[model samples]
Structures are given as structure tokens and as C-alpha cells.
Target: MANESVTLRQIARKVGVSVGTVSRALAGENGVSDRRAHAIQDLAKQMGYRPQPLRRQRAGAIAVLVGTSESGHPDEDWSQRLIVLATRASAELSWHVHLEFVSRNDDSRRAVAVPTVVRENRVDGVLLAGDPHSSIIEYLHRHEIPMAMVGGRAEKTGCVCVNPDREQAVRTAIHRLFELGHRCFGVVLSDRRYPSTEAFYQNCRQSLADHGIELSPRQVLENLQPNLGGGVIAARRYLAAGEPLPTAMLFTNDWMALGAMMTLLEAGFRVPRDVSIIGQDNLPWCNQMEPALCSMDNREERMVREALVWLRRRIEGSPCEPHDVTVHSELVWRGSCGPAPRGSAPNGAGPNGAGVTSPAPAKSRQADPSSISLASPPGAS
Candidate 1:
């Protein structure tokens, strides 16, 4: 067996930090960055060193996620936005933000390829931005790591969650559309399956049902990417079907919404008048459209703030609320929706499809915004 007489001096030397820093971190002081604090603490324990007063320091926020190539990561900006927010937030809290993108297949062959930060035991707690993968969840729980999931479900145990009220989002969107006299509805979803997307799809279909509207199987599109290109394909696919399109369409995200709008316009359709369309995330592009795209805001900004507050409480050994927290979504109404058209045209009936050309749109969604951001997700200082 290894000797158990390891000292703080040895631990500090091994961690490559000053003794005072180690003491402060191990004693649970607030100044050190959480990543460093967790790293130092883990090293000390590994060397059989014990901290005085048995305190644990946690002042770091790490963005643990499965990363795809940039092309596959359509939400890259979304992740970046969260980092910027976390950095700014942590600065206010005098904490540090850590980030590392774990490849999707990184741990496929290993039993549990824990993140470097977690394996090192650097943070007293971990804040999960969303549901990573099952492997990630299992690793955290098996290690008994304290974690708080924002915008995602908490795993089996030792975890808390801050989730978006997607049901409320659906309800709010449907109510708004109904009040605007839009009876026929359609939905476009991201081709891939994600917890958020699945939730949105289910809630939206259910909400429409609750409002006495029928969302036929064909009216829903879920075969394209979750980005602009996907939206473009969706519009084309709908046109090829030669079905009478709904008066209102809902996109899972703004990118897809913008794409569909552009395609529909090119095919001689008037937005809102021909088809009122809205999307989720309320991205910056919403304002750039000639008639801004209305959107359901996920309130990720508020969720991040709340998650940070919760993390601080947990790491600092302070009183914290229950294990679950919810951030309700809000719908930001804009020009993308209006009174339903008296007569709806089939996609194949548009000008590009051998039909009479539509009149010049009152407000074309063709003017490109110089800058646009698909807004979603945030957290803490």
C-alpha cells in the first residue's frame, strides 16, 4: 500500500500551484478559479493528502459537451454565446469559466472516459448546460459528482435541473396564432432527434390538438437539418407534395424559419398573407427580416443566471432550493404572423409551379440582415 503521510507542501508542488493557493482552494475559499480549485483538490486526495477542516472549493464552470465537426455543429454560435455569458457572469462572481468539447465518440471504447476536469476532481460541483449523452450522465453519477443541468433533464441522482417550459411555449404560440385567426397549422422540425426538439414537437402537436386544430402527419416536416439549408429543403419538399399548405407554419428554430421564408418568397408566396410563419429561439435575424419573424423565446438567458446562482449555493455549502427549477418560455410577437388568409394555395399552385404569379409582397422577407444570430441558451456570476 502507498504511504498515507502526504503533506500539503507535496500536494502543492505536485499541482504546480503555490501553497497558499492550495490552502485557500482546499479550505473552500472563493478567490481561486473553480477549475483550478477542483484540479488541486483532486490531486491532493490522490496523493493521500487531506485538507484542513475538510473543506472543498468550487468556483469553476466547465462546458462539457459532445462536439461534432463545425459543419455538423449548427448551434456553434449558441454554444459560443453561452460561453461569453458564462465568462461575463463568472467575472462578476469572481469565478472562472472552463470549457472543453468532448468528441461524440471519444469515450465509446472506454468504460468511462471522464472529462479531464472531472477526472482531476477540480470543481466541487459541475453545471451541465444540457443533457450531454448517457455516458456523460453515468460517469457523473458513478463518481457521485454534484451537478446542475440547465435546459436539460437531470440524470438519475445527485443532480438538479433547470429546464425550459416547452409545453408553455407551445401553448403560448398556439394561443397567439388562434387569436390571430390562424386555423390551419403546420410544423417543421430539426431532422435530428434532440431532447429539446422532441419536447417541442410533442408539445406543439399536443397544443394544436388542445385548440381543436388537426396537425396532419404530412403537415409536419422533420427530415432536414435544423439549420437554414434544412428549411430550404423543407419548403421544396412541401411544394412537391401538391397539398394545400397550412395558413401558419411553425419552425423549430429561426434558421429553418428564415430558410423556408426565403424559399416560399422565391416561389411567389406572400409571408403572413399567404402563410404566417413563426419559429423558436427568437434569434437576432428575427429583426432583420422585412417583416420580422415572430418567435417563442426559450428564456435561456434567465435559466443560465439561475443555474449559476444554484451552483454558487451548492459549492459554497449554502442553502439551496429544491432539486428542480423551471424557466418558462415567452413568445415575442412580430410581423411573421397575421390574420389567416381567406383562401390558401397549394405549394404547387405558386407562380414557380405554373400557377398565376402572386402580387408583389407587401413586405418581402428578401432583405438580408447585415448581421443575424439564432439566439438560445445561457448562465452565472
Candidate 2:
């Protein structure tokens, strides 16, 4: 009988006990009587029973590090989704993830803080939420830690990068606005160190140039904050000038769009009525607002999911290719843009406030101070 296949119930019968008592005794995981545990272990050895592998019990953990300030409105939705997916995927492979938020208050301090986390093995891998934190990239590489970045480029080797094709995204937005007859363009953005901002301006310039339009530094407003207050600031100055306001405005993000909407309403301008507005990051606010914001659309869930898959593979010593992915954004046209106002000049119109009527190629007349060319294509005269 001992040499034959023996189930827990058979062992319980042999021991004159319940299956529960036999299981507790065989586990030998404490709280069991010495005599019962010894008997269960001896019986299990006789029955050729063995414990499960220890690796199956170990679920590894990864860490998520965010570069932005915590106090600031942490756009965790993007990172949160990534963590959730990673967490579930890890469960399949018997792994887990731990999230950590890192501050960029001082660039110098950022470098030191990252490697320390790696040396301590606090997180098996790291996921940078938004924009590339170059300092952390350098530190992690130095320690040979696996890491992934979403929404920005990664300079380090073996680092997986997932982000939207910003240039293409911006081009899509501008192209749609142009199709809607928006010749005068207004841009609201934060004057920050983010690469997305740089890409945005570059793409905006390239898109307009493709359409034979040129924008001056002044024509494109740069505010430190990409929030409502920033939009109000730009709009107030633009409106107070009493000059012809831009028929359309493109913000770096949705928060600024909210500000622009409020400012336009206060200044007696109806959205898509007097001026059209568009923004990036189709946040929830876009649909929640009364008129709803018109902006770029992104598959944030896809980005997060793919990033985690890549990170998991790299963590497990699997041969994973380092990839640079660019998710394209589609311009969702709502009630924001329309035909150019009657009598408005074409792409290369005069400056918004300079009060100088001019026409033709902007480059040829850019040197001439007397002729003010408003690169923003206004929809109205």
C-alpha cells in the first residue's frame, strides 16, 4: 500500500485523520503536531510525493518611476494603465510590480537617486511614465538594470521605448485645421524642457511649411504653464491688443485648451463661431466640456500594454529587441474649426496685431520690419 499511489484521503485513512489534518501535517508549515508532521512526511516519502517548485511561488516585482513633480497634476492615467497591465501580465508569469515616483526638482540629484534603487534591488525593472528622464536612463544603464520609457525617446542601450509619433501627430492636427480653412494659427504651450514640446513646435513648423506658411516666434505664444491659466494669459494679451485675434488656436495640451475656451467666452467670442481651437492629449475633459474639445487621439492603453510586455521579456533574460515605437494620433474634428472668415488673407497673411496688410511668401518679406505677417491662418477676416 505504501509503495502504491497514495492520495491525501488514503493517507488520512492510514493516519486515522481527516484529509485537512493530513494536508496540514504533510505541509510541515508549522502549527502542526510534531508526531503528525513526522508521520505525514514519512508517508509522503514512501508514496513518492514531492513539493512544488519554489520558482512558482516567487512572483517578481517591477518598479514604475515618474519624472514629473508629484504636486503637479500627475497624469497617472497613462502610467496607471501601464502598471495595471504589467501587474496582470506578471501574475501570469508569477511576477509583480512596484511603483515609484521620482521628482525632477534638481537634475543633479536625479542621477544619484536612481542607481541606489537598482543596487538595492527594490524593483526588478523600471518604467518611465512620460517623457524621457535622461539622467535615470544613464544611471540604470550604469547598473545594468532593465528599463522602459513611454512617450519619449530612450538613449541608453537595451532600453525599450514606446511613444507616439509626435511629428506625425502634430502634422495631422495642423493638416486637419488647414483643411477646415484655418489660415491664422495660434499655439499655446509650456516653455518647458520636455522633448514633446520641441517635437510639437518642429512638427507645427514643418506642417505649415509644407503648406507654404511661415510662423514667427511672436505669433506662437509660449507660456510656462500649459494649463487654463496659461491659455487665459495668452488670450488676454491677444484680445486686449484689440487687434484681429487668431481665428484658430492650437494648444500643446488639453489643459491649456480649457483656458483658451474660458478666455474666448469671456471676450465675447463663441467657440467655432468667432474662433476655432484645438489641442493635444485628448484627455477626459475633451468630452466632458460643454462644447467638447477638438484634439489629437491616442491609444494610451495599447502603448502601456506593449511597454510592459517588452519590459517583462527583458527582465526574464529573454532575447528582446529594443524597439522605438511611435503611436500616431488622429485629429478628432469637433465643432472647433471652420472656413476662413470672409476677406481673410491666405496662408501667408499679415501679422495679427502689427496692423500692416501684406501678402505673398513670408520668407521674402520676413526681413522687412514694416510688413507684419501673421503666420497664423485666421478663418475670418
Candidate 3:
């Protein structure tokens, strides 16, 4: 009878909000607008509604972690970009921010630890840039720290994980490649430990299988180093392997694509004609490539901005349940991607002619930190 003495719907109706809003506001979670949240809260108390007591506290600072190599360099250029964007967003919102770099071994190593600010519960919440180690994720949850991740898929971490749709992006890329008549395929990848990267890789292979093209083991190059140099090596390995080159290649990110694309050109393999390429992250440098690399627009900036807003709302007490959100990405067609070479359907061959043996010109650049130019490219039907 006490529980039914007054209901959320009654409180919500009196304050002109959904019962959901009243629940969130009362529980001190994020979702409702500031003014409405306060009004709903005030009305609930006035209506003699008794809700469970909440012990949530706000420390006024947010911890932003960027997963990096033990040497301190980010795993991908996008990781570095996340730190810059997070810092700017915090500043613009006048939020106190704590920045930390974590070694890739964090999930397993005893030496790497969560930052002191987070350990002592000194921050309102934590914002992870890319994929931090699972141990780091565990520590946050153990402390009951509210969290929102920008890029990586931290599944079941009990936090808000948002990003461009990785599975859909792969499906979109395959659809476009299929439309252009591509069959046999190659790939450049990072370790599948990252949920986002894993999603993209698994779906790419599956999508191709749907069209009857089985991706070959020999053609898949796992990039140990996620930089341009790693990309270059992967491309070289693809060339040296006795396997015939496929007509299209896919990369987990733009960095791998840039290095591999340039290497292919130097090796006398014309892109799209000899081999087509598509990569993720829709980076600005994709436009500068000799043949403007084809890429998926992952909408990084929007994810970063939305994550901050999420943290702020949870800190200030808004009223909506946090759920994972996937934004759509449009495959931007460019010069680097073209139809399969005539007669190259199921797969193709090495170096076109016997006499071709030398290097060639290459090109690229990252976006400036001062700009937030990542917009969701329009989705194709």
C-alpha cells in the first residue's frame, strides 16, 4: 500500500512530464532538461512521494582517458584527436577535466592503475576516449563511477557507449563494393580486442560471404603498429605473399588505408583499377590522397560532444536512462574506389605486368585540432 500510495505517473502528470522523467530526476540520473528536472523533483517532494534515498555526489571534474602505447603515443591518430576534442569540449562547457594516458596493457597488467582522481572518487564521472583496458572499465564500475565512452564499444560495461554504426558501416561498404562488382577482398586490421574494430572486421567478412566472396586468410594483414609505418608494412606483406591480389581492400581505419594505398601505388598497383580501397574514420586527409581515399564517415566529433553532454547530465541529475546509440555513416565515394577491373570478379593477379618494379609518389595530412568538422555524411538509399 505504501508503494502505491502515490505513483510516478501521478507525479509526472502533475509536473507535465513522462513517468520516465520523474524516475530519472528522483534517482538523480541523466536525461531530463535542467529546469524540468528541478520542477519534477520539487513536485515529487511536495506531493509527499517517498522515493529511495540517493547517495550520488558530484566532484565537479571529469576524467578523460586516451588508450595509448606504453611509450605514450596513442594507438591511432583518432585516439589523440579524442583527447584534443575532449579538452576543448570541457573548456567550452567550463567543466574541470583530468586527462590521463593509459598503456594498452591496462586490462591485464598489475603495474598500470586507474588515475588517483578516479580511484578516490574525486571526479563526477569518467569519459573514455577509445578502448581502454577492460580492467580500467572494471575499476570504474567497482567505484560506481558514471561513465560515457566516445568511440570504442565497451559492451556490458554498464556505461553509455556511443559511436557511428560499425556493423552498418561495413554492410554499407560491402553494398557499395558489390554494386561496383567487387568480389575477392583483402583487409588491413588492428587487433580485434577493440570492440568497435572487431565489429567492423567481423561484419565485413560476413557481408562479403553473403555475396559469395570468401575473404582469404593470406589477404588479411593484421597491423601490429596502427600508424603509417604499420600500414606500409601491411601493404608490402600483401604484395610479397604469393596469393593473387583481390580487386578491393578494406581497412579498419584511415591510417592503414593511407599507408597501404600509397604503397600500392608505388608498387605499380593502380587503386580501384588494380585494387580498390575503403577505410573507416572519414578523416580529412582522405581528401588529400593522390586519388582521394574512399572512407566511411564515423562522426567522431558528434560522439565526443554527445558524451560530454551525457556526463554533465548524469552529474547534474537529468531523467533519462542511458542507452547505447549508433549514428549512421555514409560511404563517401572517391577516386580511390572504383569498379573491379574487367575480368577480376572472383579475384585477380599480381603487378599487372612482369617488368614493373620500382617506387612512386605518395600523399596525406590530419585534421587541425581547432576545428570540429566531422559531420554525418548523408546516408545513401
| Every candidate's lDDT | 0.65, 0.63, 0.69
TM-score of each: 0.70, 0.68, 0.71
From the highest lDDT down, the ranking of the candidates is: 3, 1, 2
Q: Tell me, what's the RMSD of every candidate? A: 10.2, 16.0, 13.7
TM-score order of candidates, top first: 3, 1, 2
Number of clashes in model 1?
8
Worst 10 residues of 3 by lDDT: 353-362
- The Cα RMSD in angstroms, rounded to one decimal, for candidate 2 relative to the true structure is 16.0
Instruction: Give the best candidate by TM-score.
Output: 3
Error of 3 at 214 (Å): 2.0
lDDT of 2 at 31: 56
lDDT of 1 by residue, 23-135 (tens): 66665444677688779867866776632322255435443343333313525445666666666766787765556554332334322234656656665666665335445
> In model 1, which range of ten residues has the least summed lDDT?
350-359
Candidate closest to the true structure, highest lDDT: 3
- Per-residue lDDT over 60-152 for candidate 2, one digit per residue giving the tens place of the 0 to 100 score: 667766655552345534445556665676567565556555554345422224433444565667777655345556546644567777755
Report how far residue 368 has shifted in candidate 2, in Å. Answer: 40
Model 3, total clashes: 3
